[model samples]
Target chain A: MSIKLTILEQMTQVAREQGRTLAPLRDDLALLDSGLDSLGIAVLVARLEDRLGTDPFTNSEDVHFPVTLGDFVKAYENGAP
Target chain B: MALPEALSLRRHVAETQADRFLFDRAARIRIADLVRGTSLDGDPTALHGRSVLIATASQLTSALTLIELDGNARRLTILPPDIDGAHLGALIADAGIDAVVTDGETPHGLHDIPLHVACMPKVVPIDRGRPEHVRTEWVLLTSGTTGVPKMVVHSLTSLTAAIAPRADSDPLVWGTFYDIRRYGGLQIFLRAMLGGASLVLSSAGEPVAEHLLRLARHGVTHLSGTPSHWRRALMASAIGSISPRYVRLSGEIADQAILDNLRAAFPQAAIGHAYASTEAGVGFAVDDGLAGFPASYLEGGCGATEIKIVEGSLRMRSAALAARYAGARGASLRDSDGFVDTGDMVERRGDRYFFVGRKGGIINIGGLKVHPEEIEAVITRHPQVRMCLVRSRSSPVTGALVVADVVLKPTCVREEGRAQVKDEILELCRGALARHKVPASIAFVPELAVAATGKLARLS
Candidate 1:
């Protein structure tokens, strides 16, 4: 239960902070490799920099970046500064 | 030798090779015992030859070699740029020769080059040389266009010698047939020519729709491209177009969807793409994907070969190696066992190898090896930048300078307080990165300048 909530908490906080109260879980937690267009990715990158306190990345044509909130957090921990 | 030495005329090397040997696909025109006194056609009296610049795909090394051995001509073959739309003038001026043998003209943006006064290009020939003897050596130019391009020369003997043994793979192999001008295109050309398969030439400057039109018209059994190329081609097919007998991806990785797409497109045409280099010589192992993407490999003893990763760079022994960089100091590139270091970085995965970025792609910022993609990723994170490019430029104190060319987000209006976005971006990188990894300079352009096909141009 604790692990599952820890995983769910980031999305919960992002939704509350952005005032996007009822947005679907799948939309908020999309992966980097999947097919998000340019504008959608820009929003995700901005939110990541704000939440993670790490500098956001330049845009890429290659990967979509990670989608799941847990996956994004993990990538945040491991990614270069 | 009865051959017309190059100091005479400037044209196809075939014209100069009077008595030595003749190699067109499988049509052998060797100088027989009684034919030693003859000269090849175009035996010009003014052997103070016109200059010729050759530009065929890398796999045409066999034809190139046949030219080198038979015709005593001084031909200048220009190198292809890594990201496309690069200049051939510096290369032209460096060599001081005439006439060029290049892939068709479109990829080169040939007319933009006004300085190229002596430029003459020969398209990749669609004919075949005889089975026993090899004919041309297609020289390959590396991606870096800043200095004289790294020349990977291959010869006719080395190119054609591997034909018979590998020919059995036939219509079953995944990548043996593609456009002869593409890096992998030339490989397929050589494979098909050596194996006795018919060559189907593609129409120049055609879109995916046009490509499928040609494919249907020519009854094309096989198709090949980079990952991006494969994706676009496959997407185009969804609208009901390109259906080849075979499908393969080279020049880049084939991920999960790419593999699935190939299997779906040419269920009967063997599906595969080989990871090869001009230095490594084609013919490597086929990988089964574990991650979202599959890796590549070259089998043990595929040819007279050996592989090494010295200081994290890939090197190989290709019997079909070309001799020297045309105008550089005349030094040979043979190793102790005659294997050349390919300069590609690789990681071992069981018995296979995966491709990484180039060694030169590593930007050394304050004694750090920072991949440009890493920095570019951060810049892209700013919801305001649309596209980004990272490259090393001139630096006085630090050996090389890092510069970023960026296209801002569509909503970010260019006028009235837009300049603050640059500072915000610099501040963002300053917070997340070390001092050096931050770009020394940044250029905010309207749009990123890329080729017609979507490859990023690193060098101007």
Candidate 2:
């Protein structure tokens, strides 16, 4: 699966497991308001780390924490290479 | 009022019922015979008034040596099975050990001790002549959060202050999953010795199933282990083989889930969980089938032990508390008022107080302190979850993030709704815990590693 699809699927799965309904997985949607709290985002990052074999958040010291769905996926894609 | 003469362990053994026995996996020896015989191949008088270290490979041999040397030696330091090898030199120097006792080959790092005595399981019946008047100082090691373990000093009176001799004439067989060298197991050993009860002991490498079968074979009337030890026992198929009349738990926070599960497993047993530590002696035990003790325990006093809470940590003051820390690295064991500060943290809820976790075990998430045990208590409440470990995983976003490793019941593991079970557990955490305390992810594990201390191995 593409990075975007994997992130979106994990986000939905995390949200559903937490008994929360996701509004949408649009690129422009604010990550904070997309029906998941910081805990959900943290879980998503951890799950993504398991699937992709790397954690973009921990790959670099000065890397920014992504703010939206698009930035989250891009962070992984850019850090992948 | 006249002060009674202090009694040593050998004298206590001489006075107890003659039929009591202490059994390990391989051999069973009558308690009375232990005092009549000696495991030391060397002259017993050579060890008198010398600081001796009992560093044996077998718990049974250690027990035999302790029985022989308690009053004879000037100082006897118990060396636990799980002590790290690197700390031995410091320990020997710290305790001022002059003589060494061993079962087989001398334990590594103790070659330089002045006197080396070889001990074997087989007892030799020799007249170990006259008793001495010196009150022996007993030294026990406590595992600190970092560095070498501190040597906690105690006398026979302090160690056995909480143990009350049983009045019943029936043969009460006691068994425990803890090594007798540690404080918890030592208490059980002392109780069995002084109360005229037979004890079934645990070895270093014995499997849980085999231990349960042995306990069953001996017909263990009273059994004790940590909550972690009991959880592992409950998972074993041989759990139904033993029917202990009394069950006790200590050495860790006994949560409601474990207490309730033990009650279901042994409905006939009077289940209780006690609070004790290497430094504080034994504080109290709650036998009303509850997780924590009543809030009244913190009032004026409970029995002979006075309980007080200073800054959310439990502090106990009693004759049972250790006298002081030994060695040059030793510090004052008690506070200004002679209270031993047990590092366990408890929170008051209504008329009772519950242990949250160790004060040193808190995980920092986004600068907020979270106790992993609080989350574990919530996760293990689910019927499908057998046991769980809540730990902190380093996170880039927040300094650290919480995660859980869960072991499901045998039946539930083969069930179809694994994802659904995970969902329910996460939902349970979401409802009961704060956002930060909720585990960011959960992983299903077949089993969790228990430490040599009979507690969960929470390795960072």
Candidate 3:
């Protein structure tokens, strides 16, 4: 599966577990504002790190918290082995 | 009555039992040698009444120089060697530091003051200037839960009031996971010195297994670490071979499972966990093979310290409280009765009170509150689980939901066994925790990252 698809799937799974239904995933959607709060972002980051085998947020010296879905996917893509 | 000078204790130890102080990796350093090597005997007038910052990278050198400076009447502030240049500048400005004594390169923007490294042995005779002792202050930085590290002011008297003098013959080889700059680590460092016991310093940047091996080689009988540190050390194969006489846990809540595991591992060791903070100083230690102190300790049973529960949180009053928070404009740390709110939530479990979690970290889950530590304790009880972290996950329906990240034991890494272990962990949580407390999701990680202070990095 594509990394972006896997990210969306994990987000959906986390949203469903939290008993909230998320809208269809889009690249420009603001993660912090898109129904998921800081905690949700944290869970999503952890899930992505597990599936993708790398955590971009921790790898960089100057970590930029991903504001949108595209930036979040880019972090994983940039850090991919 | 005026308190005894901080250096006087060291002098007495050096005079009587010079051969028994610290056991570094390469050699056993005596108190007499430490005093002679670091003492400012050449120009006492230069450092008199000056505020000094001790920021050495080596724990042994830091401890030695801290004692030397404090003994010489130089006001002292301890900064971790790895403190960022900006943070160091801020701390120096906040504390109004005059001079810094360090082995590391002086940070930029602070090139005005004198930086003294560990000096070679000087043969000048010790001069006893007038018997009057200067009022000295030891400033320590708070762990900075609020992102701004507050400087806590303490006197040598207040810091050492609880430590009882130990006989010279008592055999003690101390080891600690905390850096000497931290309040928890300072307690062990001071305790070892006060007792004239030998201590094995754990060097920073070394592997846990290697440090444990060094301690074992030095015959470390008394050891202390945070629960997370202990869990990691337990995972290390070298830990089983090291026999400690006294095991202590601090820096985080000591759950029952860790305590039980330690007790089972070292049956002869006296297991104790202390609840102490930078502002609160040393509170109390529970030696019983339980998670929390007995309920009776709240009523002045724990020496000079007094404990009370206010608004479901623990508050304490003691002679050992930090004098005041530095640079805090008119901020009061205590109430009229001298009780400082600890900001830690406690739940009464029958006769004992157990720490639920920090008040600030409480997860509000659709009107039900859950503490991540409680969930972590339950999750960590599984034999296959090496370490676990529990945190709140944001939810649209509920304000937050419980989530966990677990690190399994190495033996449980088989693909088929991993699935079964996860199921078993979920089952264990369901049986042990409340419905809302059970984690909604559990992610397995290879290893958990630990902070520089040797604590599990919590999601902030």
Candidate 4:
């Protein structure tokens, strides 16, 4: 599975746990404005680590935090082996 | 001025106000009988000036024998009875131990000095002169994060410097959740002796409810435990029945939630939490029913200790600092000005400074830092969490993510109830914490294992 899809699925799981429903994902979607909060982002990161076996954010000394869904997915792609 | 001639434990026992100084469930031992029992070993003169390892299973026996050995001027290293045999041998060799005293069968290849042999009735009229004024060193084992326990050396006088002198007619029955081998437990053991108060020793492998009932039966007025121990005991139905005058929390970060819960549970108890480590010796304590000490304490407001913050980590220097780490030659314990970096990260909030967590334990989420303790404090405030351990989970995108293992209240056991409880906890975190600080995932645990020192076992 793609890291981006895995991240989205985990975020959806977090939303469902909180009893919230998220709309279908899009590249231009503002992640912070989504039903997921900062904690949701954190949970998404953890889920992605489990699926991909490496955390790009921790590996890279200097990496920018993603604001939009496209950038978030790109961050995972760049961190992938 | 030479350390006030090192107060002898034999003299202290002789002058104790309490007739019954210790209760070990099996018997109520009087101080006089304890003083007289030292003669059963014939003469400890040969054992004097030797380094002895006392690894007795019984707390009372260890305390009694420690007094006798210390009075006879023997350097002592008190090890927990359950210590691994290989590790024990290594420690013995490292500390240059010449003899050992045990209540049980002695381990092979170690010279056994029979201190318990004297506990029985023997007609040996051995007079070991008046308690000598000599420096007696105590080596304590620290349960370091790296798994290798460090031997911390301290003198008996330095260990008891904070203990107040015995007062007239003060009948304080002391109780503690820690085993006597640990530094936290030894403080309470010494405190009770120094104040001439009776101690209700909690035996190892006993249930919290059972210990609380025993303490209540003994009319224990002073009690101490780590915050994790207190939270577990608070869940017990028997907790509300015992009323203590003095309550202390140590060996762990005493969060505001635990402090507030303790305050509500024991309104009359003077709730205080102390900060002390094996190498750091005894630090200051906060008693205002608050999470942390006042910011004013940083500028030498806490007795003779000088406290400072070096890049977010708390550092301390005091007269009670350990002389040196045993077996580690010429290792610098303190900086040039004598301040020891405590490794505990502290943050200033208005007028108070709160311990966030250990510097090494912080979780970094995509460049954002979050303290696991801060998340734990929030989750435990929900009233359903009996105890919780927050740790980091590696993330592909973020550097690390927060995860927690929670032990819920007994009533919230059913699958349906647990689900609802988890949801409620998530909502609580959403409201009470930043998004990054909330745990990414939480697994409900049947029980959390507490370290021998009574603190929650930090999951690596």
Specify the highest-lDDT model's number: 2
Interface RMSD of each: 14.4, 1.8, 7.5, 3.8
RMSD of each: 14.4, 2.1, 6.8, 5.3
Task: Indicate the DockQ of the complex predicted as candidate 4.
Answer: 0.30
**How high is the lDDT of residue A68 in model 1?**
60
Deviation (Å) of B164 in candidate 3:
2.9
lDDT of 3 by residue, B192-271 (tens): 87776777877878888998899998888899989989989988999987999899999899998899888888999999
| Cα-based lDDT at residue B70, candidate 2 | 85
Q: Candidate 4 lDDT, tens digit per residue, B1-460? A: 1135455776666775536568766657676665545632546665677787876668877887777777565578988755656566668777888777666566654544433233222223455565445567899887664544778888877677656565556688999988878889999988887777888888888888998899989999999999988988988998977999999999889988889888889888899999998778778888899998899998778986789999999888877788787884426778888888888999998999998888887778878888888888888888878889988776644657788899987878789988888878878887988767777777899888887778788877
CAPRI level of candidate 4: acceptable
Q: What is the C-alpha lDDT of each candidate?
A: 0.47, 0.87, 0.76, 0.77
Task: Give the number of the best model, judged by TM-score.
Answer: 2
* Model 1 interface CAPRI class: incorrect
Cα error of candidate 3 at position B240, Å: 2.4
Evaluated on the second chain alone, the candidates' TM-scores are 0.55, 0.97, 0.92, 0.92
| Candidate 1 lDDT | 0.47
Ordered by lDDT, highest first, the candidates read 2, 4, 3, 1
TM-score per prediction, in order, is 0.51, 0.96, 0.82, 0.84
In angstroms, give how far residue B311 of model 1 lies from its true place.
2.8
lDDT measured at residue B330 in model 3 versus the true structure, 0 to 100: 22
Give the TM-score between model 2's chain B and the true chain B. 0.97
